[model samples]
Target chain A: MAGGGNLVVTVSPHIKSPETTGSIMRLVLLGLLPATLWACVLFGISGIAVIAISVITALFCEVTWHNLRDGKGTGRTWFALVSSLVVPIGVSAAGLGRAAPAAAIALMSAFILSEAGISRQGERRHSFDGSAAVTGLLLALVLPPLVPWWIPFVGAFIAIWLGKEIFGGLGYNVFNPALVARAILVLSWPAHLTAGWFRSLGIDATSKATPLMLAKTGAAADLTAYYAPLLLNNPGGCIGEVSAFLLLVGGAMLLWKRVITWEIPVTYLGAMAVASVLMGVDPVFHLLAGGAVLGAVFMATDYVTSPVSSRGKIVFGIMCGAITMLLRVYSKAPEGVTSAILFMNMVTPLIDRSTMPRPFGVVRAGRGVRK
Target chain B: MRVRLIDLTRGLVQENPLLRLMIGLCSALAVSVKVENTIFMGLAVIFVLTLSNIVISAIRPVTPDNIRIPIFLVVVSSFVTIVDLVLKAYFPEVYARLGVWIPLIVVNCIILGRAEAFAYRNGILASTLDGLGMGAGYTLVLIVMGIVRELLGTGSITMMGVTLISLGTGFQAPTFMITFPGAFLTFGLIMGALNKAQSALAERAARRATGSAGRPTPVGGV
Candidate 1:
């Protein structure tokens, strides 16, 4: 106001989009609902229980942290109160005994309260938006059904705090929070993450090797058993990732909603199929097994962590697929979807930078100079 | 006397050599994997820092300005050698674990930086207090990092053939906490916490001084 002198401005296309982060996040959650419901039905109450605990913990942590940091109350306190009431039911549903989940919740609550002392206003417009819930659900989907329920609680905390908050939350994160949490959990407790795949529900459900694990050992009979089950979501693998058909349906919804473009999912699966065939592995099995479908459609397409342009997205996909196939075939781990997407997440900015489109009606400086 | 007391207390928090000044980080990050190793490392740093500061400050008047760096190095290296040999003789296991780090302390920036910045200009008493303060601060950080890394990485704390705590047999410790990247992450988080606490304290002090009638604000509080 003191020195109002020149008022020079430029540029014409100044229309703003109507979409807010909360709205987009809501769409993502809606798109994920189909596959999530299928996973719950297939895995039974235990599956729903896993998802419920994760979503509740994530929302509670986000709201509590934001409230304490900014000294303001959140609407989601009601949600936390409700979650606390349901903790017993959820724990019982998941077949976990009284001690572990309770202990984890107690520890997590203490940690959140302590951290809230230094909490500044976080980057999100509101705390209880659907992003944290989306992250929670995605992380749970990638986990084995019989994993200690506390693993989800711990993973949600780490995913929200270390992965998102420390990086200034939501839009600023470099890696997908769910993938980051899963990667850390996998590295930290390899035994729990890789083992304990439940084949079904109730007394009939058995702890069996995942199809990817059996395929890793080159067992033809085991591979044959995987043919229909892998696609139909009847196999013993990570909770939500076994349902390739359902995931595809969910991915189609995301594409129809315009929440995600087809560039990433198509290129990723295409590259994966080509690579798997070249590596002498069954392409269909590679596409359907492990977390490949879940990650390529859901994780790799994360707007905050993936490239912005279509070209960059394609490159990001190819790189993700190539590294995933490489790790699956050559590395000791039977699945590499999480690490591959996380690895590509780290490179998204670089791809975007290199693939930035030139402005319209602008002459190249070097050419102009020559002329 | 008051000023000298401040010098002694400053390094404990205000000018912490590890978290605040961020000097000698190589040793802090590398050797803070075990509580036992941290204890040995801390003791070694204290012995070397205090003695080196005394020797440097006592000789500062007679020492030529043109070659103060060489004189400082000589003093530091002498103390480091004594620590090295004494550890090798008495605590061979720790000595072996510490290995090159014992000798590497001679080049630690905290030692050389203090000699040039504080000891070279200050009196012997002030220099000695600064060294003690800095050494205490460094030791405190090393011990804290050691505890965090050891507990999380191994699921238990064992020192000098004794177990202080254990997470039981069923607990699967995150081995990443003891790795190199884990060290960096731990150090960064600790540093951020220290910064936040210091700033918060400063802000409270400022608020009090501004609100009240006759209180003097803390020196360099902001």
Candidate 2:
């Protein structure tokens, strides 16, 4: 009777039981399902195989490393493994069948090793967090399917180790781990990673060039051709990256679940659209091409690495979109989303610091510096 | 003899240029991609370090303190030029591979660091021993890093155009290892491990000296 009369209240900096890491990771996985299913429908068994191999390898590496280092059996390892493995497979499967096996194996191995190695040395192995796997998957998806497998591995390693762990794991990292992996991979293996594109579900996939690639190389192919396949299931790039429609569906689910906010995706897409129009390029082609939609929706809006405040998120999104277009149009590389995300990741700290919410009835300390 | 021995031993651990002082990292990271390059770099460093130390020590008293840096550079450059010529003439392939890095030996902080810190203050013989010891330590680290990077990146160990060992066809070289970022990653991890090892060794030594049970000591501390 006395317990029934008791009242409990929670305030700001409140420990409201929101979504757990596992739950958020699960949602991200769920969000990816549409794109993954689409990839399967297009690419066939080989897509499934690459995804399976990447996921199994990532899970095995994480669990084994955890068990060996921690000296105790934690059942939570399975959850982490599942989350990490699924993301990469979904992403990679989006543009599978074009990449070489050796390259894939090497890249994935490097990625897993880097994540595991770095986590082992630090406080509490966050390798089981599913973040690294998501990073690897997203990176693999954006890369041209014909790339050496080793490129993803290297990218994964850089993303997890340098991008995440170096700044202190998971929540501490300022940049999106997936973008970090993709950026490093693109920089290191530019030739293989950006060589060609593949068609989703096509029987005889060949060296197909993405619209962005054609634009960069001055190919006179009509822009409509690129836009048409992108709207459907064109496999000229990473697995989850090919179909703009699938990406939008998955992204919409994430937005609806509040897994990610609309600020980043909206501003990023908006900026890119404006930039594309200004550049005299078709805005729709830019939006549907490369890793723009995947990056803006999934990679750029990562909860841990992105800004907290609504305003900060907007700034982050604008910068990501602007830098992406700049890199795509001006830079030598065909895809700019990875670099854009990484570059914005580097600036996220400053964005957060400047954009912190003001106190009640109090003037903000450096109003001039406020964006 | 004891003083010279002490000087020699100092570079091995107490002030190991690579591990403790953290000097001469450019060549260490850059040329340590291959075992052969590592060996060549190590020998070149030893030659440059030893000769510069001896020459600098001999002229220390006559040299002005203000112009010491420039004078040190000149001496280091002269020795590096000689090494560069020798490598180019005899080990043409190594020279070709090492490229600008061989000339860059003059700028290697290890040689100049020893010249300014130890050689400029010590006797010729003592400086010579110190240089050799420091050179050996630097060489050891370079070789270890080289072996690690080469073995992982390429999955094989080759020396002077000879494949000494192969890890079979499955061993595919991570091409990243041949790039700049790979060098940084290898150097960083190796440095971290070396830092851990040095702290562990110091703790053991401190316990032995004090006749007490050794506890783990923090790195970069005595």
Candidate 3:
């Protein structure tokens, strides 16, 4: 056998980094494990069931989509499966409701079928990468537990087809697919999607109004009761939302592994903190009670959606935080993170274009146009 | 007389106000949500476009070139007022559904655009044909968009309270298809498809013209 026939091809920017796409994805999966495990401990068998169903459905969808689109099946199906499972499982573990499992399955199936159906009869089959599953999972995590299952399916379809495929697929998308799905779902079903709040384990679980909701309706509730539990990781919310501590830990791990940068999450959370302080609201409560931490760190800071440069990421984060706070306090809805992220996603191209790093030893010209 | 027919037919494809010129998009996007609203708006536009064009063309010779813009506005506004009043008095239901958009037609760029571009230069007969063609084109686009949006948004198509098509039991509208963003996406997609079709047709025509000349081929002389 000729050695040249079996030779592997590689390209530069050949300066090697330790990370591979699979490694980065695996790190993200690892970062999510703590919150997922915590959710399981709190929510019990329903949580486990949802995770199983979501993962299975996501994998099935990915395989089916790949087979239909590419006319041949390949590897990476398992990764897609796991990524999809994470969202519904995360939501269910946070106590979305009994419908979580069924909804996840339906959405996964529909997303796969629709994507497959839309492709031409004899195009090269698209890869069954883990991206769609990851998007579905992230969207599930941000959504309220009480959302009708069909909503996620629509979100997944929009996120995958419109947000991702319309711009070409996966890495080409300017925004996070998960955040896109979550935004559409929230906007479409504000009443059902934003209402429910399930408490954490060993906490006095009650159907009390969320702090953001209370702020919106001008109906004040006892602040200490809500604030303390949330700070200590005991507040009621979506699966990953209950534990600010765990999310931070995961975020830190992501930063340490160089899986994500410090600019977006740091600026976003800092802005939220500053804004909360300036508004004279409990800063701790604002950070802990809603999807702010999870969104800022995990969803908004998605590599595809967030800004490319360090400074751009910082500006993007601050904008997201400020908008999230404003919407939470002044708008009709309880959560604003998803919308803020999606809105920021739309402007990412502009941000990247304006803030591209200057070439080495080059003199800059006059001020550029503003978006 | 022959030139007038070309001017009239141009609006059907070459100068389609909605797809080609991208004029009057606000009402086009908003009212295209329902087949009924689209039809109503389309007919209203036709009436307004024709009347405004004829009136503008009749007064074109006397109207000063410097003040033509304002004079065109006045003509368009008067026609819009007439439409608004008539609709309010007779078709109260459509009047209510159309709401402020009917009055907004006075300022619609399509009306003003035609008044300045075509009606001001052409004779009354030519202007009338141009107006009719443009109105017909606008109506066709609106109806197509309305059918698409209504069918997708509600999972059914209804015209004047009669259901033309339904997706059957357990089928519900996406709801977003009727909202603002949906309107943008739908308009964008339709515009894109229109552009694609137009280009493809042009390419085919160019290819046939080029192929015949370059090859020195005789048709039916094989």
TM-scores of all candidate predictions against the true structure:
0.80, 0.79, 0.80
Ordering by lDDT = 1, 2, 3
* Candidate 1 per-residue C-alpha lDDT over A1-371 given as tens digits, one digit per residue, 9 for 90 to 100: 44666863558767768887788888888877887888888778667767866776786567666665666554544455456546644566576666546644664465445444554565434435688889988888888887877778778878888788777778999989998888888878888888867776432223577777777886545454566777776568888875788888888988998989999999999999999999988898889888888889989999999999999999999999999999999999889888899888988889999998889988766778463
Query: What are the fnat scores of the candidates, in the order listed?
Result: 0.60, 0.20, 0.13
- Comparing candidate 1 with candidate 2, which one achieves the higher DockQ? 1
* Candidate 2 residue-wise lDDT, B1-222, digit = tens: 346477888877668787678888878888888999999889999999999999999998799999999999999999999999999999999999999999998888899889989999998899999999999988988898888888877889899779987867744455677677788878777766666677778788888887896564565632
Error of 3 at B53 (Å): 2.7
Residue A245 displacement (Å), model 2 = 2.2
Q: How do these models rank on DockQ, best leading?
A: 1, 3, 2
CA displacement after TM-score superposition, residue A172 of candidate 1 (Å): 2.5
On residues A159-223, what C-alpha lDDT tens digit does candidate 3 reach at each position? 66666765656678876876666655555565656665555464654555655566456564666
Chain A agreement with the truth for model 1, given as TM-score? 0.82
Q: Which regions in candidate 3 have their CA more than 4 angstroms from the true location?
A: A1-12, A16-22, A44-126, A196-202, A214-220, A227-235, A366-371, B3-6, B123-126, B151-169, B195-222
Scored by lDDT, the top model is 1
- Comparing 2 with 3 on TM-score, the higher-scoring candidate is 3
Better of 2 and 3 by DockQ: 3
Ranking by TM-score: 1, 3, 2
Worst 10 residues of 2 chain B by lDDT: B213-222
The root-mean-square deviation over C-alpha atoms between each candidate and the true structure, in angstroms, is 6.9, 7.3, 7.7
